[model samples]
Target: MKIKVNQESCIGCGACAAIAEDLFELNDDGLSQAKVAEVPEEKKEQATEAMEGCPTGAIVSE
Candidate 1:
């Protein structure tokens, strides 16, 4: 599946990046952004958790 971070809603809490390091990262602006074009097969579950763990619900599946 594909994912993207909603920049407007992100709080730069680093939760998504911390929960799923392979799939998300904190950008230079300190907000989370998807690191890959798609969530890799092995990392899908972790990606989901990261999305769910986002306090502001900024991570979106596309």
Candidate 2:
């Protein structure tokens, strides 16, 4: 599975970071973006939680 973030819909909320700091980050633009770091299978669950935690509904999965 892969996760994608809609940068425009992100509101700079740190929920994703809170849930999975290794998977997502707040860039210099102050919007949430996925980290370049590879996401392991074990981390996918937290990543999904983080995606769901976004109040702006900015996350998509494929």
Candidate 3:
């Protein structure tokens, strides 16, 4: 799976990082960013939760 964050839409709520710290984080710009280019099978579920939990819909998965 692949995941990405729309920086423009991200509100830096930390939900993604809280949900999947291994896969997401807040950058210096204070927006959520995907830490990995590809989502590992083991982390997919958590990534999904992060995506769903993002209030700004900044997270995207494929």
lDDT for each candidate structure: 0.92, 0.82, 0.92
Count of backbone collisions in candidate 3: 0
TM-score of each: 0.95, 0.87, 0.96
- In TM-score terms, candidate 1 sits at 0.95
Clashing pairs in 1: none
In candidate 3, position 4 carries an lDDT of: 94
lDDT tens readout by residue for model 2, 13-55: 7889888888888889988888844568899889779877889
Instruction: Report the C-alpha lDDT of model 3 over 1-62, residue by residue, as the tens digit.
Output: 89999988999999889989999989999988999989989998898899889999989877
Ranking by TM-score: 3, 1, 2
lDDT ranking, best first: 1, 3, 2
- Residues 27-58, candidate 1: write the lDDT tens digits: 89998889998888999999899989999999
Query: Pairs clashing in candidate 3?
Result: none
Candidate 2 local Cα displacement, residue 29, angstroms = 0.8
